[model samples]
Target: MATLTATILAGGEFSSPTDTPSGRLDTTGAFPFVGALEVSNSVSTYKGSAVAISSNWILTAGHNADLNDDGLPDTVWSGDFHLPGYGVFGIAETITHPDFSGFANPFINDDIALMRLASPLPTWSIFPSLGSAMTGDNITLVGFGRSGYGSYGYTSNATLTDRRFGQNVIDTLDLDDEGSGLAEVFRYDFDDPSTTGLPGGSLGNGTETIIAPGDSGGAALIQTVGGWKLVGINTFTEGYGGRFGDTGGGVLIAPYEDWIFTETGIPEPGVGCLLSVAFVLALWQRRRHCE
Candidate 1:
């Protein structure tokens, strides 16, 4: 078993070295759909984060499934996904994006993957009808990995079971900083709300944060009119450490929504209407009332 680090957040007040278990674990159960991923190969075990997008499907980083960088799933690697209050489930299969070129270059892009669970979860989270992400949009990041304060970056603490949530605004949609000719990726910086010298100029939501090593497959979700929609998948980070001023982002879900929906058998919001007739009727009524 391998213990992996998680995410780091701005401000020393948000985290402390003494905060055992993790810097911040979501005890409120606000994000039950987010979970922890542990995959083991013949050599070593790897850890990451994942999110339940459907009853039997999970979303994660491509590298999590193809740890050997062979552009295919490791033959000996077995995956276990742990959800809060839901216990652990075995991954039946994993499907990495066809464009993922492995982790040789940090900026290669197309780092998304889908995992099918052996058994369906009782519940899951919903995605936007049209997947899209924009600059200045605040996104909620959730992951189960290592933890530390922005003042010093990620620590050596091991807490793979704790899930933490934080917020940060999208600073750019262009992958220029990640190199040219790469697929689209949305980037966000870890901003210190008390300082204005950062790249995004102190755009922190107070709980601003940056992902650490084990948080590679975590989620970057944005709230929408319908509900919370997953906009990005945490893939890579560009910084000395998980400290202040660090920039991180992942593959934009919009461009791969078609592949995801088709592979996972999850219908687009307005396509097949997965929700029950009564539920749809209630949602329609609610929308009408708001209108």
Candidate 2:
């Protein structure tokens, strides 16, 4: 019941890719906390975006976590899937929210997921603060998704290897209240700049950075009083290609911060780098596997 633009692989689809339109590669100087998520079926490889919420934990989409829908993964890894800014890291498992009932629940929501890394990240890695997204906040969407726009965009099976970032303002929020297909997520527009007053406004002046197939589980960041906030995770889009009026959606992250902390004992410090390796060593030795 949900229509999306994520590149399809094997039998699953990825919401957006690593390469965004007119964006640049994110290095430790730019986007060190973000990384590329890679999935494989032995012979083939696919990509998605992964947000490192903690030193040893990654936040991504539920679908990206387990692409096969069988609750078992053939292989999962992050970081070195693409580009040079990131280093390769292996994912131990995909942990979906207990309340997430796939993408077709009556609420039409809850696609959030997290992954555990084999080791803890260095202290230099940043953890974005948590903030509530309102209707008018400006958002920066980044990914290594497909390159090009519309028909020129890469195919669902395409494997892009670059990182890019785009900008758009929040079109709407609390979508479930609208009872529309966009329920449970926030939306930004890829409208024509000529089309003023369009919902969420067009991409506006300068380079229009819209999410394309391959960016699934990437970061939808919003700046707050504290600093840049990790507001959402790339979920889906209305159109497959880079057509105009295409809307990108990501699950809200602030709502689930508590669950993430309780499960992994990872501290929640959005702004600045305060991740203490000493605090999480015990959990590291006694990692609890999720169902």
Estimate candidate 1's alpha-carbon lDDT, on a 0 to 1 scale: 0.72
Model 1 residue 220 CA deviation (Å) reads 0.3
Measured by TM-score, how close is model 2 to the native structure?
0.73
Candidates' C-alpha lDDT: 0.72, 0.61
Please give each candidate's TM-score.
0.80, 0.73
Q: How accurate locally is residue 247 in candidate 2, as Cα lDDT from 0 to 100?
A: 62
lDDT of 1 by residue, 74-108 (tens): 78889999986888999999988877767534343
Show the colliding residue pairs in model 1.
5-145, 5-146, 6-145, 6-146
All models, RMSD in angstroms = 5.9, 10.8
Instruction: Write candidate 2's Cα lDDT for 1-291 as tens digits.
Output: 344344211100122232333334443346666667777654456678777877788887776655554333325433333324446776676678776655544443677787888767777777776556767777777776765643244543434445667677777765543444343577766655555356555444333456666778888887667667888887777664656556666777766767788877756454234345654764676665321
Q: How many clashing pairs does model 2 include? A: 16
